[model samples]
Target: MGKITGFMEFRRLSEQSSPVVERLKNYQEFMPRLNDQEASIQGSRCMDCGIPFCTTGCPVNNIIPDWNDLIYRNQWKSALDVLHSTNNFPEFTGRICPAPCEAACTLNINDDAVGIKSIEHAIIDKGWEEGWVKPQPARTKTGKRVAIVGSGPAGLACAQQLARIGHDVVVFEKNDRIGGLLRYGIPDFKLEKSHIDRRIDQMRAEGVEFLVGQDIGLHVPPQKLQDEFDAVVLAGGAEQPRDLPVPGRNLDGVHFAMDFLPQQNRVVAGDVLSEQIKATGKHVVVIGGGDTGSDCVGTSNRQGAISVTQFEVMSRPPEQENKSMVWPYWPMKLRTSSSHEEGCQRDWAVATKELIGKNGKVEKLRAVRVEWKDGKMHEIAGSEFEIKADLVLLAMGFVSPVQKILDAFSIEKDGRGNARAATDGAGYYQTSVGKIFAAGDMRRGQSLVVWAIREGRQAARAVDEYLMGSSSLPL
Candidate 1:
């Protein structure tokens, strides 16, 4: 520890965001970073605990204490090296990750935890500015070729790791550009596409070939991929959105969150929209109070919506957590995102009953208050109400990976419909079909980017060991 009393002397400090008014005008990242001296002070707040729960909390299992010490000592380059050793894309995680690590920090029991994510953000941004981050291609060739379907964080990490180990890695993406959800599903306000573009350039230089517009099970045949590559990795994400089947389910104004968010991202990227779903001059109601729903709220306000209301079926979470009960694990607490702050009317314990419309288009939403009892939800009596709404967005999370793709491969699926595969024992990540493996959302269901990257890297190691008798790649 640079200063043993740092945690007591200094409270946690993180990135400052752009003014809400200015940031809401454009779809650009707004988080301002701390200076080097400030970052070092935050790093020194790390307790250097005997058993670091932060590492365990992090999905990628980053060496938290080591990097914290490195940064506290002002060894910025070494901190980046240690960070990259485990995570292939710290920038993405630093920006978007929820930082379960902070919740699991030992200091969080009664005090503020170390600002690990902010420090990580500062370190990686500095690394890029200094040109310390560069592509390192393998020195020799393994001659084993691998094809990875989907170019999200998982597929990208897997391809990068395999390419670094002298293996031929090719990524197939169904979209016009790579980064799957990162490129499109996320708004440029949350994560700029430029970050994804720079990383794609680095991966290309390292010998990872990317083929866009290749939709397996639709445009690209599964058999063709099998025939072309020695092995295949299905990292395709869960794209099926969980739908709300209600009285006005087929209404003209109803749409999925993915369909709405991607359009704004495209417009921000300079793509012209002939005619689009505009919330301008209309009352917007968004269902499902998760991140996707929040994104929809932010987008609607930017589109000049008359007003925005977000509904959540579940009861409101506690503002503060019981640290003694949830220490070293994620807690149930209210999380208000930056988008929520821009301007939103949030309602919890509310359920949508129907959509009232005019001339086949939605005009209002009928909803009722809900109460949970005995693990089952009950609608409260006389609580029905109608609210003005011209646009309705279903922001409920995804249910599973597209069933068509799973059926095409003839791979068995778990109860949740995700590809049935384990991460341990013989043939880890291997599918029922020989020589085929699955990772990320395909195998584990929809999850965080960090978890997806971790699974992809581990699956790459598994595939490498399966191909060559032995392997040295880190999982």
Candidate 2:
């Protein structure tokens, strides 16, 4: 509303990225945040729509229009405050979150949606640069100890909220580092680790303790946390990756995307592995067409792979969606990520038949073209083909959380193997086990990082109310 006709005057402007040839040489963030003027212009494009669908579209329900107006009015610090009021880590969401908010924007019905993500990216980056982001340690202690399992976005968000509310919070991570997936699963090219590191520092200053290499169910028994802490929150993500059960799946060259992705991230963090999976000089085939698969393609191209190919079982989506039919909602359409633009041979509606290999090492992949009818798949006759593939990465989405952790605590599980917990009513986020709660992927299955943050924040409020008999924390 800062400029009434600004939406009509300005067009959407996306952030620029480094050239493909130049960026392929290293694992670093390619896209730079919009400059102050560009961000302000982008913010001004926010139309004064009667109802802001962008907020409802976002999992965290970010105050979009307010911040956009603030940015347009040159109130950078206030914009940062509005952003942090809802999102615990806008930096993470700003960098990696697929912005559903943009798809649901009022302007997206006919014209390009406002560049909300870029404006958010600029706001948070500027907040850090200007020292507007700092520790907000609680003034009074509640004397209640909370144990948070998993140090990803969910656990971290929960810990920060509880800590800032005067509760003693301790985050336990199985990995040797603080960030769980953020430190390992994602490539540095998409989101550098320094952002996570700085946030960790701020959390530490806020009185949240982080204990790395501490496996809760394994090294530290589940009973210890329940006995020691007043409350326990399980924010561990879904780690059980879906597998292709075709013959030769156990071949040496075939690996889960998690296995391959984390190693590269660790290497980028200066850890030298004794035996690491590399795509160097090999024909790489990444199965699955989601973000994980795109990550594999980018990493493979950077690792000097002879060739990189990506396969999606589903048919290719249209390049553009029919806005009239799908307006104010996320639409199914083609999305080419920065990794895809780097270099990748992409094919859709192809299903892998089997892995063809020599000497227990995968050498090629045999697949078939298939057609879908009435929600059923039918293989096309004589459409089988084989392609050279020295490395095959299974990038299909994760199916469930590791069952062992749930079993260790005797927690009830849903039909999908996620911890059984409700989001509303009494016993919200509470597991069957007393004093135990579940949030994020552990409760809702694998989802976006923004959803994880939303779950974490809400779970914190639930726990707060359970402890103090009342909570002022935002839901």
Candidate 3:
């Protein structure tokens, strides 16, 4: 408590974003980080609660209070260190995380929570501007090689930790780039690929080798890794998209969200496309109103879609949650993303009946309004309607990691199709295959990047202990 009554004296300040019309003009980051004075005030709003529920709420378990105080005092270098102590990459989480940490803050009981995310964002931005962020190479060599299959957050975090602790780490990415979802899945407007590229440069300096365009099972045999490397970490994330099988599912205009989103990302990366799917002059309809669906809406608008509409199977959530019931935990509530604000027609509690197409190309969709009773959905009588849609994007979510790679190693899978592995007690992160480990979405299913980083760091610790009978790596 640097200023004893700072929480009572200061009000929370949110990050500022550019006007919708201006930002929609191009694919670039629009939110400007909080200035120094504004960040210090936001940091002062921290209650410094006895329990500090914000840390419990954050998946990475950041030491929030310590960093807040450091930022309030304008000691940014120290604040950045405290922020990075737990989280390997604050920049990614600062930009994309939903910030459950704020919802669980002590001040959020009756007042606005401290701006922890924006403060973190400011700290990291300053760290980079001042050239404070750098790589830490191992002091001694372990002479043991570890192979990580995936360039997503989980694999990257795990490899970084192992590399710092004297293990020879090699990251194999199936795509032409190093970042898995960060490079392709997410839109550049939210997180530009340069952040990932810079981190890759740092990792390279720390002695981690990256081999792109190598599909483990298809391009390289799994046995070769088992025979050559001392250990392997399977961090291949959940890549299977959920399908909407309707009467006109095979229509030429229908595609998965991943298929559409990645194509646009490639174009932004200066790649010329021949078979690219475009929303130009088309009426776009995005199914399943999650982050993926919202992303589709933004991309379609930028691609010059005539109109964009989003549909959700579930009923609309409450504008505000009942904090009494869900305090200190993530609650269900209506979330309107910046993309939605750009321009979108949102409808909830709707069910897709079938796709109505012409000449094998989707032109419209048939749907009905539904009501939920006792957790079961029932279509309303005479509530059928048709919506014009030339492009239909399935953005419901992912199911599991690619099964072929797992099967190649003969790894046991859970009921959810994710690799079966324990999180604690002996055999932690170890798969059915000897000397093989699984982490992140490969073991846990689809999740947030913060959780992926957590799993990766913990998995690295487990692997280190397994190799040397102990580890200094933080959990």
Candidate 4:
């Protein structure tokens, strides 16, 4: 620890966010990174705990205490190195990850946890500003070639790792641009696209080729990749959104969160759609209380929606968790995102019964209050209600990956329809079909970006071993 008593002396310092009034007018990142001194102070708050539970808590197992000590000692470059050693994209996680590491912090048992995410954001931003982050191209080239499907975090991570180890890597994206969900699913207000753009540039410099609008199963034959490349990695994320199949679901204004979100992202990226879904001057109802739903609320407000309301089928969580019982583990609790803070009417334990509409356009939503009893949900008597809703966005999360890609590869699938692959032991990450590997959401179902990166890195190592009969890359 840099300072033994630092945790007792310092309080957590959070990043500053732009005013809601000023930020709603545009789609741009509002949270500003902490200055050096502020970041150092936050870093110093890391306690001298015997074991850093934060590392185990993180999906990528980042060396939190080491970086915290480095930041406190004014070693910014070293901190960035340590950060990058584990996380391929700290900027993405620093901005959007829920920071379960902080929840598992020893100090958080009774006191505020260290602002690890803020410190990470500062380190990475500083690294870029000082030209510390640069291309790490392999000195020698291997004859082997690898094909990666999907340009999201997992695919990008896998490609970068394989390329750095001297293998020829080509990433194929179905969309016109790289970054699967990051490019279109997320709003710019939370994460700017420039971060992904810069990484793409770095990857290209590292000899990773990217081909857009190349759907492996649809446009391009899946057999071509298998024939050309030594191995194929499936990193495509789960895109099968869960649907609300109630009455009037076929209404025109009702759409999946993916359907509505990507259109706004494309528009922001200067793509003109023939017909775009907008929340302007309309009563918006976003179903499902998750990050996607919160994003809808933010996007709706930005589009000048008359009102924005969010619903959750489950009961509301406690404002605070019992740390004594759930220490060193992620706890279920109420989490209000920045979007929720901006403006939103949030309700829980409410289920939609039907969508009332006119002329094939959704007009209102009929729902009812329900309660959980004996592990089953029971509708409350006389609690039915109707609310004005011109647009309904279903953000209930994804169920599995698109089955067509799996079918094209003739790969075995798990019971949940995801590509069947293991994460440990021999032939790990290898699909039942030889020479094919699956990682991230394609293998593990829908998950966070950090988990995807972890799987991607590990999958890269697995592929390296398979190709060379051994590998030195980190697992």
Q: Model 2, range 162-219, lDDT digits (tens) per residue?
A: 9999999999999999988888888999999999999999999999999988997779
Each candidate's lDDT (Cα)? 0.91, 0.95, 0.93, 0.95
Tens-digit lDDT track of model 3 for 1-475: 6766888898788888999889888999999799999998888888757999999999989999999998889999999999989998899999988898998998888888899999999999889999999988999999999999999999999999999999999999999999999889899999999989999999999999999999998899999999989999999889999999878888989999999999999999999999899998999999999999999999998888999999999999999999889998888999999999999999999989999898999999999999999999999999999999999999999999999999999999999999999998897999998899999999999999999999999999988988888999998
lDDT of 2 at 217: 73
- Give TM-scores for every candidate, taking all chains together and pairing residue i with residue i: 0.99, 0.99, 0.99, 0.99
Please give the RMSD of candidate 2 to the true structure: 0.6
Q: How many angstroms is residue 150 displaced in model 1 relative to the true structure, after the best TM-score fit?
A: 0.2
Q: Write the per-residue lDDT of candidate 1 for residues 418-474, one digit (tens) a residue.
A: 999999999999999988999999999989998999999999999999999778988
Report the C-alpha displacement of residue 243, candidate 1, in angstroms: 0.4
Number of clashing pairs, model 1? 0
Q: State which candidate, 1 or 4, has the greater TM-score.
A: 4
Instruction: Score candidate 1 by TM-score against the native.
Output: 0.99
Clashing pairs in 2: none
**Candidate 4 at residue 279, lDDT?**
97
> Across residues 225-314, which tens digit of lDDT does each residue of candidate 4 receive?
999999999999999999999999999999999999999999999999999999999999999999999999999999999999999999
- Model 3, global lDDT: 0.93
